[model samples]
Target: MKPSDPEFQEFAEAANLPLLRTARLLTGDWHLGQDLLQVTLTKVYLRWSQADRWDSPTGYARTVMVNTYCTWHRRRWRHELPRERLPDRAGERDTADTVATTDALARALADLPRRQRAAVVLRYYDDLSVEQAARALQCPPGTVMSLTFRALARLRQSADLHDTAVEGR
Candidate 1:
């Protein structure tokens, strides 16, 4: 219930990377991912009392992110065009191939529909179970499976992603 609790700060630090990565995948841009994570964290902070009682606050935060993204989808004005250049990375990569692969994947993911993107990220990236993903998406388990199937199929078929190595889970 404490807004400035040390426990909550520790939890936030531990969850930041995974949450940010999931947000990045969901939004198809690092900047949008930062915003998504900030919004989700703000919501969690506002409900600190309830969140502190949870056994899995990271999962709850992720659910909030998915829900927020879905809410954003319904708002026409929230959609924006992609930027031509990516933001600078904090560290230099040792290899060019790694950069190319990730760039291709990001572009491919950006082309996917929102639900498809969410489904893929939740089910694969987050390694959530079908039921878990379904709950996060507020849909039936069957629907989650369907979305995952369609999303993977689309990703597999994408010409931009054709040359990139994909590992199916």
Candidate 2:
């Protein structure tokens, strides 16, 4: 059960893809997902044995990513806002469009309160049961359900705006 055990590494490897996807959903940016995954994996590596003993390694990693993000947000002044402008990319229309959509999604996600964003990612992206997400988030199941509902409502509103912009283009 020790993180150093060979079995632990195997589990970590198996969990990597889902962890990456969850990270992407949580951060709404591929680059941020990479950074989040790296941080999460490093934490997992440090405590592999203990984490391996958990019923769900994926859940543990998700929790770690969420916590790390929340901690980062707290350390930075809450008033700090993300840049509203997209980066310049010359001669790659496809790449530019993708980046724009990604940035839009990231902005939407970033606008959400941390707990609500975590709830959406855990329930929708990870497809964890309400009970499981509650356990991971250390909140009551009812609270998880409430957060999930609010998160989805907000995301739907953002999606509507995105659709309108695309249709007008």
Candidate 3:
């Protein structure tokens, strides 16, 4: 089916921004995030009928994106290179504090082990329930709870986040 199919188009339009945000967090790179989102959308397009039948289309898309991300993580060829310099920004200097907090959170997220990061993203960022996150991660709900606890602890312990919080206050 074409991407312009009404059902697929509607789902894509509704879920696009949240999917992109989740993808960016999963991949920790904007370009990779875009690529991931494209792959996700293509997957959704191929399975549009089944996806359309899902109770929560956005949740299904998120599951696909997370699973795809985990697959990419397992493959060595899909490496995300660390950048030595920051990307250029536009002239607007508004919301500097918000930007810094986001950057700090992203960096801390990058430091988390893959499963922990996935759990945190699914549970907190995606606002999935423990049972839901567990299903998405293919683990038990208790594991999701533990992973969320540990991930949040790690983020709290991060000196980068600590410094950002101190400076933001």
* Candidate that scores best on lDDT: 3
Question: Per-residue lDDT for 1-169 in model 3, tens only?
Answer: 3234886788798889989988888887787888999999999778876754676777777778878887784432347567899779855667888989999998899899878898998888888899888877878999989988999999999998999999999
Give residue 68's error in model 3 in angstroms: 0.8
Ranked by TM-score, the better of candidates 2 and 3 is 3
Q: Each prediction's Cα lDDT score?
A: 0.82, 0.77, 0.83
Better of 1 and 3 by lDDT: 3
* Candidate that would win on TM-score: 3
Q: lDDT tens string, model 1, 69-119?
A: 867753222466677997787456565667778888888887888888999
lDDT of 2 by residue, 1-169 (tens): 2455676678778988888888777766666777888899889777775864687777777778778865654222235457789678666445665656666766787779888998887887778899988887888999999998998789778974477468548
The C-alpha local distance difference test score for the whole of candidate 2 amounts to 0.77
How many backbone clashes are present in model 2?
A: 3
Per-model TM values vs. the true structure: 0.77, 0.71, 0.78
lDDT-based ranking: 3, 1, 2
**For all the candidates, what are their Cα RMSDs to the real structure?**
5.3, 5.3, 4.6
